[model samples]
Target chain A: MDILVFALCLAIGIAAGYRNWLPPYLTSRSSWGLTAAVYLLLFLIGCELGSYRSVLEQMSGLGVQAAALCLGGLLGSALLCRIVGGGGGV
Target chain B: MFDPKPILVLLAGVILGAMGHLPEGFDDLIGPLLRGALILLFLAIGFDMGKEPRLWETLRSLSGRALMMPVAALLGSVAGGILTGITVGLPVGLAASASAGCGYYSITMILLKEAAGIEAATIGFVANLAREVLTILAMPLFVRYFGKAGALGAAGATAMDTALPFIIRSAGKEVAVHAFVSGVILSLIIPLSVPLIYRLLS
Candidate 1:
């Protein structure tokens, strides 16, 4: 459901943009809007995280497992993309 | 941390939250507000993408090859999951589900809680959050060491938004297109993949 919303909203925005339907005021400030939204999101995320006191309290116990998987996933993808991705100038 | 401003804002929020500074009813509103913010963020990003002079042309040039980045992300994340399962002594499905969250912590946690339980959900939350934070912190280094595709792959589903600025800063604008496409693809895959893999394997 959330995925559908994400794709739908983005598609709507894209279509509106293609059609020049966005107001001039919005188009001019879109970058700032994007950045502000991201910061707002980060703040919300932090609030969400900090509110989960149980998670924070139990972090020590969960830390090792989470870290291992996180590092492994990140490194594995890094290597794999290097091997298979041709960098695609990505 | 080339860009510490966002991180600082995040820390401020965390501090306040930890202090129980939220007004009454605010906690309940977080989820809905988060969704609203995400929608706005996506629309903004999509607008920029569409506004590009040669949007379709750029995407067309990327073509099928762009799809490979998501595949790489999946394979790599699975490999990580397997190792986590072994080392952490978690069930195969549980570990895979958590690791496969692809930096999408919120939905992944909710889904895992329903499907697997709070323990799996916790792991999913931590693991996915770690992916995003790690991507943000390591992006510059990844671009320097792993090149553009590696950076994009490391970002998983976050490359579209949270991790994009870093990619754009470290890599050029050209790579940003692939990053956004890869992010969108991975984002689509994660919700389906996380629970399905759990149900199938567990």
Candidate 2:
């Protein structure tokens, strides 16, 4: 559902841009706008994390398991990149 | 390409939030505000992509390598998750399901709840949440050392949203589109994979 909404917004934005529906000024300053939006997005993510106090407690209690899984996934990804990443690094 | 500025903002937010300083009614605002900001961000990304005259040409050239990255990531995540689960004494099947969430907490948690029950769902939540936090903190370094694919792999399903900006900043605009495509594919696959894995395990 979230992905669908985001995709819909992206498609609408592209169409709007292509057809000149959005004002030129807004389009011109979009890079800055995008950056600001990113800031807000991360802030909200942090807030969500903070609100979930039980999650934090769980994290602390199960720190080793969580860290192990996270690191293992990342390591697996890196290893896979070595095997399947045909093109050189960007 | 990586900037310290945005990360500082993220850290500040975390600090303030941890300190219990979010304003009254702020909790209510988070969901809508996040969705709204996401729309605006995607709109900006789409507009930017549309304006690039050579975008199609680049995507064509990059598609093969780009397409392979996410498949690799998914495989790696499952392997890693199962490995962790075994080390931690969790059933391998349950661990694989949790890892299948691939850093997409909400979708993974809900799916695990329905398919594997609340315990698996909780593990999924923690594991996927850990992935997101790790991606946010380490993406630039991943790009710097391991290249664009590593960053995308770490981002999992979040390459489309919370991690998109950092991916762009770290890997550049060229990789950003690939990240979006990879993220989309992973997001689509996750909904099915979580349940399928659970069922298979059961």
Candidate 3:
């Protein structure tokens, strides 16, 4: 059931995007329709995270791991950029 | 420069969750909401991409530089995983999460639940979430110091959405397309890389 709902939402979003409806929302800065939709989605993500706060606290010990991942990702990305000769010139 | 919508939504979710008073069917709301949000985000990304001037010219220029972003991201993910594994004295899933981009939160949480249980899943969730936030915040700086290619790498998984607009605005169309393509590719690789690294290390 949840999967179905997700699929439906995804399909709708993609369809709307493929049709180029989202652009007008931003260009016009219209508040009533698509802007509301975008805002709603952002809010939902925030809510999801907030709902999981207890889990977040319990897992607080993973902070070091998080920091390491951030640094490692940055460094690794840099090296890759250099090796590939892609990022150096940009 | 933080957008207030996400903050408000997060607060709303927390409050609703705390109340613990949702009706019987209320549980069904989450899936649709999240899916809808993701679609909106993606669509916004595509729409913005379509509007960039001289989009092809920028893309043509980025062909060389864009190739390096994923490699850099992969390296970062591995480094992160190893550090976490050593510190935690357990096979931390940092590699996958870092490599996968922000998508790690959803995929890692699922994988952690099945492989390591609830505790590990929670850690993966938080770690991935932090990575997403960091990517968003660091994108402008990376673009400034390292240019479009660097910004693409720094954006990690969010290059297609959160960072795409800024990248397009700053570096022009080619860099934006490069960042988007690179981000999508890296995001796809995250799931495979996370478990692969964990297995290799453990």
Candidate 4:
């Protein structure tokens, strides 16, 4: 269901863009709609996290473990991809 | 591209919520409002990708090596989690599944809730959100040192939407396409793989 809803929105938008369905004013980046949408999502995500009081409380106790997991995963990804990917840089 | 403005806005929202400033019954509204906003964001991102003048030309040029990006990302995350989980004395399954969320917090939490319980779900939520924030903040360094796949792999599902600005800024528009592709692939697969691995390991 999560994938379905996400893909449906993306497909609709792609079709609209491909077919020039949205008005130029909206489709153009000048409207800053995209920026607004992104910022809104980020803000909402923060709100969602903050609303979960237990999660917030647990953060203090479990944060070190979480950070360790994050770093390990990140480093493993970088190392493996670096070895195999030839460091395809910008 | 490394805009601190969005991060600041996020922190402001967090402070407001933490302070209970959102008024009574706002909690119920947050989920729906966030969904609406996310839909809009996804649409905008898709439209931008679709309207790129060289979209097809770029897609056509994708190499076999580029296709391997998500694989490396998936395995690397699992390997890292297993090792870290052992070092930390946590369940390997628990840590691996959480890290495999690939920064997609909402879905990862849901998956953990079903597969494990609320406690495990909470851990998954935090771990994955950290991955997202870290990717947003440090994508440039990941790209500079570890290469495009390093950043994209670390970004996981966010390589498409949440992490795109950083990836594009650090790696360029061409590699951003690869980021989008790998992100889409990981997004699709993570939902499936996370659960299976958890069930197997547990």
Candidate 5:
């Protein structure tokens, strides 16, 4: 369901973009628009995270696990990218 | 380009939420509002992608290989989390779930809370939150050391939003689009993988 929403939304944007459907002013402001949308999304996510009292309550105790997992996730991906040579050069 | 505004705003939201003073129905409004924001973000992404002349050409040439980055992200995080769990004497299942959060703190924590318990959920929440912060902080370093794709891997599902500013600045617009694709794939995988991993571990 979430995947469908993501794909559908992307498709709509692509189609609109391909046809030049949006107003010139809006298209010109796309960068800021995108940035604003992302900020709104992150803020909402923060709100949701804060609403979870249990998670908040126990946050301090989980520090080690949090550090370990973050390091692990980053390190693992770094290692894999190194081996796979995933750089396509944008 | 490497603006501090997004992270600051996110922190402000968390503080406001912690205060627990949102008016009635504001909580209810969050669901639809978040979805709307996400759609708008994706639309902008797609539009930028569509405007690119090389979009289709790049996709066609790299169709199969392009997928490896996301796959590597999934595999690396899972393995790394499990190893961390064993080393730290934490339960393997809980560690995996926390790792699976993949920088998506809210959803992952909620799901783990429902499926596992408070401890697991807390770990998921903090770990994923740390992942996002670390990604933002370490992005330039990742780009320098591991290149664009590696930075996206560290970003996990956040390539679409929270980590995007750094991604765009460091890697350029084209890599930002690829990061979005990678992010979307990982986002889709997280929901399924969390439960599957939970069930398997139990």
Candidate 6:
């Protein structure tokens, strides 16, 4: 059931892409759509965080380990880019 | 005017969480919302792809760079997983799964829930979500310093849909196309790769 829903959503996205409906939003001089989307997502994130307040506290209690994982992910990605010579124009 | 979808879905999640909803029911709603969000995001990416006139030229110019992006991403995933496992003392597989999870936060969360239970899934989801935020904030610096290939590696599969407009804005149409193709390829691998990594490490 979940897979079916995922496939359906992906199909819709592909359809939208092939049909060319996103450029106007991207190139719009006014930031209406973009701002709305960003803000909405941000608010959603905030709400989720708020709901997970206890979990956040618990995770933070885990201390340096959690922080290390986050930093490691970032540094690892950056290092990989440098090593692979990915630091050039596409 | 504010777009309602993100807000609505978020509100729904919050309300449910506040109400102390169980994982099974929340899972049902989250699946649909995530799928809906991805569809909308992907559609926008497709539209952006349509506007690129320099796609062919860019592809021609960066063929070599394009090939390197995924290799970089794969390396990043492995390195991240290893480092995290060492630091957190979690199983290397779980760490690796988290590292390779990309920006598919909801999907990763869903997978973690099914495989490891709700608590583990939530942690993975938050970590993945943080990764997305970091990707959005840091993408420009990467593009400036490393160029399109760097940015593509940094963005991973997110380059296709969520990050498509930014790539278009930062590097132009050709780069965006390259990123989009790379993103699609990465997304295909993530679902299988994350699970495999977890299984192997465990």
Best by TM-score: 1
Q: How well is each residue in B1-202 modelled by candidate 1, as lDDT tens digits?
A: 2345765876787788899988889867876786677678668767876777575665567767687888888778877777766787767888777878878776566557546755566677678788899899888898888888888888888888889888898877888878888887676567567767787788
How good is the docking of model 2, by CAPRI class?
A: acceptable
Best by lDDT: 1
Docking class of 5: acceptable
DockQ of 2: 0.37
Q: Against the true structure, whose DockQ is highest?
A: 1
What is the per-residue lDDT of model 2 for residues A61-86, given as tens digits with 9 covering 90 to 100? 45566667777777676567646763
Per-residue lDDT for A25 in model 4? 78
Please give the lDDT score at residue A38 for candidate 2.
67
C-alpha lDDT (0 to 100) for residue A21 of candidate 3: 62
Runs of candidate 6 exceeding 4 Å displacement: A1-59, A62-68, B1-11, B21-68
Output the chain A TM-score of model 5: 0.72
Predicted candidate 4 versus true structure: per-residue lDDT over A8-81, tens digit per residue: 77778778877888878777772387778756766665666667687678776577777777878777777777
Query: Candidate 2: misplaced stretches above 4 Å?
Result: A1-63, B1-62
**iRMS value of model 2?**
6.2
The deviation in Å at residue A84 for candidate 4 is 3.0
Against the reference, the lDDT scores of all candidates come to: 0.76, 0.70, 0.53, 0.74, 0.72, 0.58
Residue A76, model 4, lDDT: 79
lDDT of 3 by residue, B37-145 (tens): 5445444444443444455455466655455566666665566455644565545453444334443455555434334444555556556666667766666676666
Error of 4 at B136 (Å): 10
iRMS values for every prediction: 4.7, 6.2, 5.9, 4.8, 5.3, 6.0
* C-alpha TM-scores of all predictions: 0.66, 0.59, 0.55, 0.65, 0.62, 0.61
Candidate 2 chain A lDDT trough over 10 residues, lowest sum: A81-90
Q: How does residue A23 of candidate 2 score in lDDT? A: 82
